[model samples]
Target: MTPRPAKGGRAPAMSTEQRREMIVRATIPLLIEQGSSVTTRRIAQAAGIGEGTVFRVFTDKEELLDACVAEAMDPGTSLAEIRSIPLDQPLAARLTQAAEALRAHVDRIGAVMGALHATEGRSRAAGRPGTKSPDRQAGMNAATDAIAGLFAPEEDSLRLPPRQLAQLFFGLLFTSSIQESPQDIGPVVDVFLHGALASTG
Candidate 1:
């Protein structure tokens, strides 16, 4: 028979996967703030679970760090944000929104990886392969496709096809040193939409 709750009610039971997700979510901020030095006691406190529970979900801290890196690198959230931009919005507005989302996605990956590298002194985070990995390539393709969708409504006005335009736009984003602020990003979008040369009357 299942044991009854004490005076106060107990939280709902979580499956092994659910517990792992909970621990990872709680640990991400700590990893950013403390890097690989973040201790299991702190993680348990943050997760509101016993220290042993963390080990039950992951073999060790290295495994947990790998999970955090995976979450940071995943492009699903950014793609959803880009895809949700309304097609009715002007081309510039749509691209600006997409740019912001993509920049934030890149920033997140950098932050998590930077923190881990600072403490670990490794070229790449444990368990994450090179960018040439199939999973990483697939994520890059998905992000480009999502950005390409933004140009669909303005296909006639554009000189190049939407997919090619997207590849260029994405390249510009990754190659250039863009700040997080919208003000900084707006001019870049403007330059992309219109040539750098001044238009004469």
Candidate 2:
């Protein structure tokens, strides 16, 4: 028979990266809700780990906030979600789903950056200048390509190429103040598919 271990044995240890990921995941919502004012103690409570665990994973709160910023900016998750949209759906419905995913992506970046700006006096950069860093440009290109995939099936019916339409779609999304309702995306998709001109028929 195998020997029994002590009743009060400690839990198995997690690797450093695993611990950091856990803490960062827990902290993101708190940062969105409480901004930079969220405390390490609170983060520890949220992760169900001791306060010192966070310090062991991250050198300090600022370093942890930096990790959060990096996480918020990474487009991998959003791209995966957009790619998973079923292609058999109607063109409008597909685009709307993509739009919603992109919008949520933008919102996450905004919330984290807004929180950082509030406490760090950091300036939120504006506009797509020619000087965008290579990584930023690459991410944008990936997002555009993902959006373009939604238009692939309708290519023969489209007046413009899928890539160009994708760029135009991004333009509309950035300019329009879309809300968290299916109704809001309807008009945006309609405008993109048709036009802003009133029907004269």
The best candidate in terms of lDDT = 1
lDDT string for model 1 (99-166, tens) is: 99988888888888898889972224445453222287788889889989999898888899888999
Query: For candidate 2, lDDT tens digit of each residue in 100-183?
Result: 888888888888888767766222322123222227888889999999999989889889999999999989977887685657
What pairs collide in candidate 1?
none
lDDT of 2 at 101: 86
Against the true structure, what is each candidate's TM-score? Answer: 0.86, 0.82
Candidate 2 has its poorest 10 consecutive residues by lDDT at 122-131
Per-model CA lDDT versus the true structure: 0.83, 0.82
lDDT of 1 at 91: 89
Angstrom error of the Cα, residue 99, model 1: value is 1.0
Top candidate, metric TM-score: 1
For candidate 1, the TM-score is 0.86
